[model samples]
Structure formats: structure tokens, C-alpha cells
Target: MENQWLQVSYADLLQATDGFSSANLIGVGSFGSVYKGILECFETVVAVKVLNLLQQGAFKSLAAEWEALRNIRHRNLVKILTVCSSINFNGNDFKALVFEYMPNGSLEKWLHPNVDEQPQLRNLNLTQRLNIAIDVASASSSSFENTNHDLKPGNVLLDDDMVAHVGDFGLARFLSEAAESCSQNQTSTFGIKGSIGYIPPEYGMGGKASKYGDVYSYGILLLKMITGKRPTNDMFKDNQSLHHFAKSAFPEQVMEIIDPRLLQENAEAFLDSENHNNLKNKMRDCLVALVRVGVSCSAESPGERMEMREIAMEMHAVRDLYLEVGIQ
Candidate 1:
């Protein structure tokens, strides 16, 4: 498998990306910027994530991602095609990772489409949204069981078929048996391991990275999907957070706070039903159960959060129920 990886260098990438033109620039994050390039040797489009060597933890982030993806292979996790550790034309250190291109882009765009996106591409229906939630849970269940310190929507990429793939392991850490306890979870060099709104509360209090912290972040991500709001949305000011916002409406008013677009998409289906009232009741029940899981997982205390394995299993059951009920 090692031999199968195409050996690439700064010149190869520069040529592929036409000198890393901003037109080919796709995404940017704390550690580095990602560029869409056509690797000549592979003759395929790939995402080149070039690390910012001057950044505080750039080297550590590169090492962390490599360690996280080295032995892991999951359909829902982004595939690392190859890596380049070389020097640029100016004799500066250049490090980058090549990844399979995801044409559908990030979940963040789907949740909050930019003005430039066509109106038709703005919303994800209930079924698609549920599937994405399940995909993230499955990946987090398998991967976070070890640890992926960052688990926000922006880090979730979608393939051509819209399958969610967890990526950006720049903050990932493994939780050995010796590091599963509260004190151990506090063990880390990265100051704060995740994005705001998605970060667990404990992390703000100097807590270390842990699977439980990952669960908290996943919970917030799930809630964001359901509500169609980012954790840092302007509406979430004061003591009102995405968690409390959802929790305040759980079970009863959940249907009220759901992404209006989601309601609009399903409105026609409900209206077409001869027993529209019954269908509404069933849909409400399904949504209530999902919100319950989200609230449970995002509880203020780590001990109060649900395990990722349990979340994956529960999400599976919810998807099955959604399909079985003909809710689409």
C-alpha cells in the first residue's frame, strides 16, 4: 500500500495548482489552507492541505493528523492519499497532505448555504440530514473512541453521493487505557482543542481532550443540523447557547424550532396524507426522540453525555424508524 502512494513534491503541487492560485483555493482553517489541484501523475483531482509552518502548532497538527489516520480506515472518514514533506523553491520547509477530492464540499455550506449557491442546493431534506448525522456518529463512534479532538460541521466533508466524511484530525489524540480517566482526559498540549460553540464546556475550564469531549462536540453538531444554526450564531448571545436553545424547545416545541426549511420540505408530504394529523404526530414523535438524544449527549457534565457507540446505535434505530414510517 505504501508503494501505491504517488510520490509528490513542492514543484509537482505548484504545477498542479498553477502556483496555488486563489482560484483553486478551496478551504482554509487554523493550521493550513486547502487547494484543489489536479495531480499530473495520478491524473485525478485532489485536495492539497498545505500546513502554515509559521503557525504555533503547525508541526504538531501535521503529526497528529498523520498518527490519527495511519491505522484507521472507515468509509465515513476522509482518505489521505499521500503526504509531501519537502522544501519550497525559496528553500523554506513545505509540508502538505493529499486527500481524495470531495466534490459536494463541507456540511457547513449545506447547513448555511452562501448567497452564491443556487436556491435548489440550499436545503438538505430530513432524510439526507438524518443520514449525515448517522454518518458522523458512526465515524465518531469508531474514530473518536480513540479521539478526534475537533468534531464540528466545518470539518465534515460530503462526497459526490453526499455521504459525510469526518476530516481535519490536526487536533486528534489517542486515549490509551492509561489515559481514559478524568485526570488523563486533561492531558494535552493543545490549549483548547475545538471550535467555539462546538467545544465542550469542560475544555474551557482547562479540561484535556477526551472521547467524552468529542461526544459533547458531536452532540452540538447534531443539534446544529436539526436547528440549521451554528453554535456561534448571532441569536445565541447571552446565556442562550445552541444547547439550551434546543433544550428549551425539546419534546413539545421542537417542531417549532426546527429549520423552517425542513418543515417546508416535509409540509407537502404531510398535506398529501389522508390522515395528515396522524402523520404529523408520528413526525413529531420522531423529531422529539432525536432532540432528546441531542440534548442528552450535550449535557453540561461529561458524565451526563451519551457514549458515541450508544449514539450510533440510537441514530441507526431512528433512521430505521424514519424510513419505516414513510416519512422520507
Candidate 2:
């Protein structure tokens, strides 16, 4: 039952996961399959992760994940209920992580959403969207701000309540104060992690990971939440990334890229020049701020970026102002 991290019995994991059957499988993951399970403790519904150890080096990464999850917790960070280790068949070196189940899956699934649950989009008003972004920003400010490391969307999971919890520590790192002080270093990669497209260009070039990288990634998520476009959408298909493409346009072509779902309420003059007459038109200022924030965070120069805490403050200011004026 317990260790540095809570220990989960293999049998319970197997039973709860129905022997890892397809019926119980919730989704295929990059590293393993996630199954819906119930923990013996409180009959807690949890995500049973059966990690794949195909590569010899992957075991080390798995161990790192275990250690990282055990050492930290945050409302936005996924809670690890328990883990199962060791095995009988194939060396029975089985390893698994049991986390609180998030019925809504992830923001990625929600952004593009699905036909069966299209109505759910209605629940995400401007206030709710801003709140979601704030939650993520706060979590990032807490987690990565300490380690000066960033996580990608795959690492961000949303519970049924639409509350975002930062998860997936496989790429997280603990930077010594000494290490954090160095602004520009080549081997500066914080374990060389971050999802592609979401990865800061400097990180890809083997530079350091910082709170700014997380801020940069959050900005992308903001764009996705607003436009319902993946970082790899067709708009970005011809090698023009959204950040780069949006640089020159700002509030001008903003409507061209906003999510159609969000445009429904403003149908009368969503494109009307008179639309600028409304206070929400000032949202252009927010979008402009957003573009600057994204560009800075993803800046090839890490020195140019704002820290995550600053980002959270900026969002709070923007969202507060938006709500004050009742912008539709």
C-alpha cells in the first residue's frame, strides 16, 4: 500500500482494468494504453497506465516519471493515486501509474470536440474560456516556474469539470538554483522535452527550458481554444506556423481564424465593420497582447520572454476588463 509514492497492487490494477482488455481501455497513449479503473481505496475511479517498456532506455524515463510524480502535487497537476511495479510474466517487471480519472479526457479532444458532444461548446462562454486559460496559467506558474521547465498539451489533462490539471512529468526536471541562473547555454536543454510545434524553437536548438516556454505553450493553447485549430491546422499546413503567420495580422484577420463555434452568438455582425463599435472590439487589444505574449514566449531568444507569473497577471487583467464591459 505505501512507499515514497503510494503502491498499487498489480492484481487490483489488472482486475480494475479487466486484464487490460480493450473494453476497459480508455485510450492509446504515446507511451502506453490508459484504462479506466477503480482503486481499492474509496473505490476511486482512476486512470490505469500500463507503460510500454519497449526500449531499454525507456525504463529509466519511466523511473524518472515515478520519482517526479511522487515529489509534487498541484490542483492543476494530475493526482497520482498509486502505482504498480514488478511482474511475473516476462520478468513481471510490470510498471503502472494510477491517477484520478478525468472523464472529459483532455483539452485537445475538447478544442476540436466531437459531433456527439457539440452542445458542450455552449458551456464554454468567454468567461469560462478565460478561466480555463487562467487555471492552466496558474498551474504552470506553480509547477514549471519552480523547475523552470515546461510541459506540452499531452501533459495537460482536463477532468469532467473542465478543470485543467498539469500531468505527465516524464519531461519535467528539477533545476538547481545554479542551473536556473544561466540564461544562455547550448546544452541547456531541460532534459530535451516538449511536444513538437509546441516546443520552443530555442529548446529544439538545445537551449534551456524556462517558465517562458510554458507561457509560450499556453498561448498556443489559448489560440487553439479560441480558433478550434490544432497547432498543425491547414492554416499552418504550408509551413506557416500560427505564431509566425499571426505576427503581421493581429486584429485584422483575427475573425478569419476564430472558431466558428465562438462566432455563433455574434452572427449578426461577427464580420461587420460596425462590429468594432462594441467594447469587445477591444478584444483586439487582448489578441494583440496574446500575439506578443506568444511571440515572446516562443522567441528564439529566451531572454525576451515573460515569466509564467507575469503571464497569469496579464490574463487576469485582460479577462477582468473583458467581463467588466460585458463583451459577447
Candidate 1: tens digits of C-alpha lDDT, residues 1-328: 3886778889999998999999999899878899999988879899999999998668778878877776778999999988899999999999998899999899998888889878566679888988999999899888447655578888999999999999988754532221344353353323344476776776656565678888888889988888888888899888889889999997779998888887888788888989888878777777887889899999999999998999999998888877866867
TM-score of each: 0.92, 0.81
**Cα lDDT for residue 239, candidate 1:** 86
TM-score of the candidate numbered 1?
A: 0.92
Model 2 backbone overlap count:
5
| lDDT of each candidate versus the true structure | 0.82, 0.65
lDDT for model 2 comes to: 0.65
Model 1, residue 12: C-alpha shift (Å): 1.3
**Model 2: residue 30 alpha-carbon error in angstroms:** 3.2
Once fitted onto the true fold, the runs of candidate 1 whose alpha carbons sit more than 4 angstroms away are: 174-194
Residues 1-328, candidate 2: write the lDDT tens digits.
5555555677778777777888888766546778998766656888987878783334555566677667677787788877777683556577887888888777666565567876555346556677777887888787436453345555667787778787765544432221444444522443332355676665544445556666667767776676666777677876577676655556577666666665565455445645556645666566556555655565555677777888889889878776655555
Q: Look at candidate 2 and tell me the lDDT of residue 83.
A: 70
Most accurate candidate by TM-score: 1
